[model samples]
Structures are given as C-alpha cells and as structure tokens.
Target chain A: MSTHTEDTKDIWLDECFAAARQDTTAAPDDLITKILADAGTMQQEFATQSLVATPVRAGLFARVSQALGGWPSITGLATASLAGVWIGMSAPAGLEGVTQALVGAEAVIDVVDQYYQAEFELAGDL
Target chain B: MASIEELSDDALLVMYANGDRDAARVLTLRLTPRVFNHALRLLGDRAEAEDVAQEAMLRLWRIAPDWQQDQAKVTTWLYRVVANLCTDRLRKARPVALDAVEEPVDEASGPVEKMQDRIRAQALQRALSDLPERQRQVVVLRNIEGLSNPEIAEIMEISVEAVESLNARGRRRLAASLSDKREELGYVDAH
Candidate 1:
C-alpha cells in the first residue's frame, strides 16, 4: 500500500478503536448483585469449613486444657510458676536460710557440682 | 491496615478466601465491570455478555482459595477466564451474518461529535463480531482493552508472534469492512 493510504487506514482504525474503548456498558446492577452473592456464599462455605476443622486440629490442647479444669486453672498454674521463679531468684528475709536448712548448703553445692561435672564429661565425650 | 481499596487484587482475593467480607465486596465491585465490558466486546450481546461475566466471576470466586500469585496476576487470570467463557458461548451460538446486522438506531440528537463517535463505535462492534473468534479476541484485547501484547498472549494462551499476526489480520479486516463507512463515520479528510 502507498504510505498515504496506510496512514489513512491507520488513522481511521485508531478512531474506531478510540470510539469502542469509550463505548463501555456498565455491568447491570442485577449481575453485580448476583456476583456479590456468589462471593458471600463462597466465603461462608470457607468460614464454615474452617470453623469445623479448627477444633479437630486443636483436640489435644483442648483436651489437656479441659482436664486441667479449663483456662482459669491454667492461668493459676502459670501464675504459680512465675511466683516460684521469683522466690528462687530473691527469697524473703525470713525464708533466706530455708534452702540451707532443708537441703543443706554443702549438699546443694555438691549436687550442683555433680550436675556441672556430668555435663562437662558429656561435652568432652562429644 | 490498608483499606481494601488500596489492596491489590491478589491481596484482596487472598483476604476474600480467608473470610474477609469487605474484600469480597471490593473484588466484586472492582472486577465485575471490567469482566462485563470485555465479554460485551467479544460477544456483542449484552445479555450473553452478562451471563459470561457472571460465570467468569463465579469461577474467580471459586478459584480464589487456590490462586497462585507467583504464577499469574489476578487480572491476567480473569482475562483468560472471560476469553474462554466468551469463546465457549460463541462456539455454541449460531453464526451471525454480518451484513444482516441492522444499523444502530439514529443517535443524532446528541452533540455532533458524540453522535459521530457512537456511530463509529457501533460500526466497529459490528465489524468485530464478524471476525473469526481468535482474531476478534486478539484485536479487542490489544486495541479496545489496551492490554499489552504479552498480556494478550498470556490471556489467549498463544505466543506473542501469534498475537501480533492475529492483530494485524484483524485490523486489516476491520479497515476493509469499515472503508465504505469512513465518510459516514466523520473521517471526511482523515482529520
């Protein structure tokens, strides 16, 4: 084709394309509603499946928690653990010598020494 | 905590799959119009286009859970779905005789320029509907939809070369079919 003819065709086609691009028809309201409903229904199915699947996977933890008298008892146990750690770290004035009286300072130190010695020997073996 | 509007389609789809109702709403609003427009351009019938658009969106909702973001973009996947849906409909549909299509109703009451554009658009749509399915799809995606050649290739499941070839053929056909109507479409001197 001649250059002028080609350019003319190109320009005409470009105009056609531009017009078509602007000729969009909005999606019908009914269609949008139907699509949204489908989305809602799919989401609901997933939500239901997840809900049903959750406790099954959590069975072990649920059973253990229930056997220990539920969340309140777990909270108490956790609090007691923290208290024990605190007491061990800093004993009250009157209870300062209680560990020495119960286990004896020398015996406690010997037990600690044995533990370190065992760990050291194990490390050496490795 | 970005609003749903600010989230990408992939992110919104992931959220929708995870039971975010707002995500579902946003996706429905954001994608349905595009899906409908593309289907309309391909099918050239509003009702059939609506059906295709709805079916495509339904598939999107179903696939959101398994959507692999690293593999393809959501819009790319959607264009593929819409293209496939329209192709299926066209295959099942009776072939339309292009010359039998009636001229669009006179819309001359509007401004002159606007009327001219409407006439051009109507003429183009008629010409498009007469094309072979693949050529019509490639042309609409590349020209009307303003998608990149690579994106059209992906959507049509063809090579870029194939897309370019189909586009060239489609445009040539369109130009030939529309040649007689050029003056009527207000291209008096190509200005």
Candidate 2:
C-alpha cells in the first residue's frame, strides 16, 4: 500500500479506537454494593482489632508523655535533664575558680576596710 | 479534614485503610468503571468482568494498609490486577463467543450514526479478541485507554521499548484483521 493509504488505514484504526473508547460498561450496582460490604466488614474487623489492641487506661507517665507530644518531647526532656546532671557533675575548673574569686573579693574588701579603720584610729591617737 | 473527593487515590486508599467508609465509597465510584471496562474488554464477558472488577477492588481494599505511596498509580495497579485475572480466566476457559458480547448504545449520536459506531466498536472488539494476549493488552491500553507507552510498560511490567514494539505489532495485526471491513466501516471512500 502507498504511504497515503497507510495513513488512511491508521486514521481508520484510530477512529475505531475512539468509538470503542465510548464504552458504557460499568460495575453494576450489585457489584458496588458487594464490594462496599466487603470493605465495611474489613473496617469492622480493623475497629475490633484496634479496640482490643489498645489498653483501656494508659499509665500516668504514658498519658503525660502523650500529652507532651509523645516520645519526642519525652526524649528532649530526658536529654536536657542528662545535660544538667553532666554540667553539675563535671563542673569546669574555670567555673569553680570564678566562684572562688567572687567569694575572695568579698573577704578582701572586708580586710581592707578593717585596715583603713585601724590606720584612722592610729592617726587620731598620734 | 479534606473530604474524600478532594483526596488523590493514594490518599483515599490511606483513608480507607483507616476505616473511613466514605473513602471506600469514593474510591469505588472512581475506580470501578475503569476496572470493569478493562476486564470486559479483556474477557469479553460482562459477568466475568464484574467478577474481575470486584475481585480487583477487594484486593485493593485488603492491601490498602500496605499500599506504599509513590510506588505506583492506583489505576495502573488495578489494571495489572484485572489483566492478570482475565489472563488466568482466559487460560482456564474457552474463548468468549464474540456474538455474546453486546454493542454499547450511544445516545449522543443519531440512530444511524450510533448504530454505525456500535458496529465498528463491536468489530474492533472481535478483532482484538483474536490478537495474542499481550498484544491485546498493549493495544487496548495504548489506544482505547489512552495510556502512554511508559505507563503501559509499568502496568504490563515491561520496558518502554517492549511496550512500543508490542503496540506496533498489535496495531499491525489489528489493521490486517480489520482491512476487510474498511469499506463497511465507511473509512475507504472518506479519504
């Protein structure tokens, strides 16, 4: 066949496909109802499984943890507490020195004031 | 909460998995026609098609909880399921009698045009039934269903090149088969 005839044949085939594309066969109402009924039964089974699987009353900590956004928040709180404990247990030497320096400054001020008062009294006595 | 209508098929399936009855209804309404039509075309039997469609949807419902999002399109998955079911049925039983398949009525066209279209469609269906199983599937998916070669490849579990080759062969076979009916189908003189 010539190319033109081949093109015509292809066009005709496409037209046949287009006609077939307008098919009206659908899932009947009875089939839909049956499928939906199956789904409903499955859903009920899932519901029953969920009801049976879940505890009726959660523990206090479990409830609190859930209220606080579940495992993530609990994990964060635990991490912060551990960090605080580490800081307290492993206090850096610099921090201890700073605390000691603050206490030493107060003692130094008291001693200087006492020395100054004694000097004033001696001058008065002279 | 978005209504089931606003959800994609995957989302609707997820909702159905969570026991939302409306999601199941929406998915059924959305998917059943495509499934039914595909099965009917493959098997050429309405009752068998109905069984296939129902079985396919039931499988969907059962697998909803395990459906991996983004892995595959819902329609593609369903098409594969229906195709496999039809193939099994075809293997187990004799071929469907073409005369038993009814032509669909199109109310949009005039009576004569509607009759012509129905006759053409029926002829095509009969011709399609004569094709090898894979060729029939590739042709139906590419032509009547308007799926791309790549999509058909995914559904048929083949490469795109393979899909193209199958489609080409199927079309050639279809053209050869339908050549005798061209004048009767009113396409010979139209050119």
Candidate 3:
C-alpha cells in the first residue's frame, strides 16, 4: 500500500514536469512598431486637446445672480432657500439618531405615570 | 544588480503621465512583448494577441498618473490586464476551429523527430484548450509564463491555497489528457 502511494506521487510529479516545458510564438516585429506609432499619434492628439480646456471665468452679474439664485433684492429669501436645501438633505440622519433619544424619554414618562397610578391606589387604601 | 541607466517603472509612468512621448516608447519597449506573448498563449491566436497587447499597453499609458508606486511593477499589471482582455476577446470571438501547428524551421532536427514534435505540440494545445478557464490561466502562469504561486494568486485575485489547488488540479487534468502520448511526450524518465 505504501509503495502504491509513492508510485502515484512519482507519476503525478512527472506529469507536472512534462507540462512545465514552454514554447513561445511572438507577434511580428512590424506590428509592434505600428502599435508604438499609433500610441504616439494618440499622445499628440491628447496633448492638443488638453491645452484648449481653460476654466471659464464667471462674469460679475452672473456671479451675483448665482449667489442669490437669480434674485436682485430678495437675497435674504435666497439665503433661506439655500438653508432649506441644505437642511432637507442633512436632516434625516440627525432625526433618526434623535428618534432613539425620544424613545428613552417616552419610556421614562411611562414609568412616571405608572408610579403615580401606584401611589393613587395606595392613597385610596389610606 | 539594478542599473542606474534604466528609469524605474514608476518614474517612466510619471513621465508617460505627463505627456512624455519618449516615456511611452520606453514603456512599450519594456511591456509589449511579454504582454503579447501572454495574450497569445491564453487565446492561441496571433491577431487577437496583438490586439489585446496593444489595448493593454494603451490602458497602461492612460492609467500611469493615478498608479500607486508601491504596487506591483507596471509590467505585471499590464500582464493581468492583457489576460483579462484576451479572455474578453475569446468570449466575443466567433468560435473558429483550432489552427493546425506549423512545422518548426529548425535545421538540425531530423524529419521524424520534427513530425513527432509537431504532433505533440498539437496534442498539448488541444489538451490545454480542454482545461477550464481558471485552471488554464493557472497552468499558463505557472508553466508557461513561469510566475510564482504568490504572483499567480495576486493576478488571479485568489488565496495562495486556491492557487495551489488550481495548479494541482489543472496539471493532473493536463497529464491525464496527454496520457495517450506518454511515450511520445518523452516522459521516459519523468517518473
């Protein structure tokens, strides 16, 4: 039985060694050269495109308009609107965390109400 | 010894990122052939291999700026990319009959030896195509590309034990497939 196991191991090892031998075939030389050439052309095109993309400057009237949501005199209202938008997005998380706190407060009120009921029952006996 | 004359992969990547054309040339010179060969073995098609190799190299060119320096060398990353791209092409490719092996042009080998070699290459290629994709990749990485288990694991995104299991299973299946040709495979003393 031991010899059988050893023989199996040796055969498997031989098979692995046979599979380990490597033979290769490469891409033609001209194709590699052409790929490089194409890459170079792409690089030139990318460099040229990046040079033309300067950030656009906002004009004075546009800047003010943006700040006030297009209002000239009701800037306070715009500020309030901005605050509303911010709160709408940010309020849910804070509200959820406070829910657990409110739950604790409710439990305290229930305990106090029960304590008063117990006192009333005891007073009635007195 | 590491040569001072050669720019490190990271440095070359930085240059390529900054739109240095020479950097692309240097990077291509370093990466293209290995990537091509890797794609070739996975797909067993020359044209597809070149396509995969080109796209992989171009993607490297595109990603150089964002690449972290401490990560694997740019070339190893390219090999992984090329392998995946070959896998993708293979999926999209209309199934073609496996190509016949061409006789090698070596002058000294006698005709009988050459014929036997051709037949063996053909049989092995067939058996290799028979392997499951993951197992085939493991075998190729271990046997053909000569990558270590850790390297294969990293590229395959599997644990080292998984790599070991895959290689063991793959090699066993491969040997079984080639069992009919044991004598011709020249495994006379392999056992």
Candidate 4:
C-alpha cells in the first residue's frame, strides 16, 4: 500500500482501538463477591493442609530445655547433677581435701560429718 | 511498610496461599477488573466474559500455592489463562451475536461524541470478532490492551516475531473491514 493509504489505515484503526481502549468494563460486584467466596473456600483448604502438614510442637520439658540452651546445656546440667549424686553416695576423699582447703580442716570436717549423718538418717527413714 | 495494595501481585499471591484474607481481598480487587475487561474484549459477551473472569481468577487462587515466583509473572500467567479459556469457549460455541456485546457508554462525553465512539467501538468489535483467534488475541493485546511486544509474546507463548507479524496482519484485516464502512462511520468528511 502507498504511504498515504497506510497512514489512513493506521488512523482509522487507531481511532477504533482508541475507542475500544476507553471501554473498560469494571468487574461487577457479584463477580468480586464470587471470587472472594472462592478465595475463602480455597483458604480453608490451605488451612486444612497446613494443619495436617505442620509438625507437632515441642513438649514442655523440651521447650524449657530449648529455652535454656538446648542439648549442650542440658547435658552440662545432667553431668553436674550426677557428680553431686556420686559425691553424696561415696564422699570421695578428694572432696574432703577440697573442703579442708576451702575452710579450715577441723570445723569443716565436723560440720560435714554431722550433715552426712543427718542425710543418712533421713534416707533411712524414707 | 507498603500497604497490601502496594505489594506486588506475586507477593500478594504468596500471602493468599498462606491464608492471608487481606491478601485475597487486595488481589481480588486489584486483578478482577483487569481479568474481566480482557475477557470481555476477547469473548465479546458480558455474561460469558463475567463467567470467564470468575473462572480465571479461581484458577489463579488454586494455583497460588504452587506458583513459582521465579518462573513466571502473575499477570502474565493470568493473561495466558484468560486467553486459553477464551479460546476454548470460542472453539466450542458459535459466533457471539454482536448485539449481545455491550458497547461501553461514557457518561462524561457529549451525546454526539458518545454515539460516534459507540459506533466506532461496535464496528471495531465486529471486525475483531471476525479475525482469526490468534490474530484477534494479538491485536487486542497489542492495540487495545497496550501491552509490550515482549509481554504479549510471553502471555501468548509466541515469539516476538510472531507477535509483530500477527499484529500487522490483524491490523490490516481490521482496516480492510472497517474501510468499507468509513462513510457510515463518519470518516468521509472528518479527515
């Protein structure tokens, strides 16, 4: 086509397209409501799937341990408790020496013996 | 922090997938008109277009969970969905009665301009409806929708070359058809 013809063609088509472009139809209210309803229904499906997929939460002790610093801290506490138990059961000789160093020997030994006796008597009653 | 309205469509979609009701509302309000208008243009019937719009959005909602943010854009995916749905409807149904297609009325324009624009729109719609499906899709997206050639290519799953070619051919076809009615359309003395 000649340039003039082409320009004319473009002008008319451009006008028509321009008119069409100005003619956007807003989505009706019912359509929005229908889509929102679908979204709500699908959200329920997502909720259900999430509930099923989510792993169970930690128990109280596990949570507390986690708060306190998880397995490494728990392990340290367990070790200290076991050491205390061993000392109470066997009264290791080195503990007495350490106690003697901390406090003068005579007074510390007398009080320590009395405490151990009372603890033994209490254990017997139990 | 940006309001929900300011969030990207991809972000809103991700939020919707995670059961965010506000995200759903925002996305519905934001995307529905665009989807509906595109459907109306392609299908050319209000009720059917409404149905197509609702169905397309439903697909989007369903696909939200599986949507790969890196792979595709939300609007592109939605446009492709609308196009496919329209193509399916067009293939299964007979041609739409042109009278059933509502010409958008502008309350702001003068009566003479309104009628002229209506006639022009109706004439354009008739010519568009007669176009081949691919050509119509190309023309509507390129001209009416004003999408970039690359964007049209991605939406239609065609090369940019194909988009340009279809766009040219479609415009030529539309021009040829409308030229016969120039005197009736008021182009005879207008310019």
TM-scores, each model vs. reference: 0.72, 0.72, 0.64, 0.73
lDDT (tens digit, per residue) of candidate 4 on A1-126? 011233234676687788787766778899999999999999999889988999989899999998999999999999999999988999988888998888876763354588789999999999
Output the worst ten-in-a-row residue range by lDDT, candidate 1 chain A: A1-10
Q: What is the C-alpha lDDT of each candidate?
A: 0.84, 0.85, 0.69, 0.87
Ten-residue stretch with the least lDDT total in model 2 chain B: B101-110
**For this target, which candidate reaches the highest DockQ against the unseen true structure?**
1
Interface RMSD of 4: 5.2
Top candidate when judged by lDDT against the true structure: 4
lDDT of 2 by residue, A13-48 (tens): 888888888756656799889989988988887788
Error of 2 at A102 (Å): 52
- Residues A11-110 of candidate 3: C-alpha lDDT, one tens digit per residue: 5334333332323454567767876886777677667766776557999988877876776556777788999998878887777668668786445445
A20-46 per-residue lDDT for model 1 (tens digits): 777667777999999999899988888
Candidate 4 local lDDT, B69-118, one digit each (tens): 99888988999999999999999989777677667645676678767877
Candidate 3: docking tier: incorrect
DockQ of each: 0.28, 0.26, 0.11, 0.28
Error of 4 at A101 (Å): 58
lDDT of 1 at B179: 86
DockQ-best of 1 and 2: 1
Q: What tier of docking accuracy does candidate 1 attain?
A: acceptable
Q: Over the stretch B26-139, how does candidate 1's per-residue lDDT look in tens digits? A: 998899989988888888877888899889999999998888889998989999999998999899998766654433334346687777788898899999998999999998
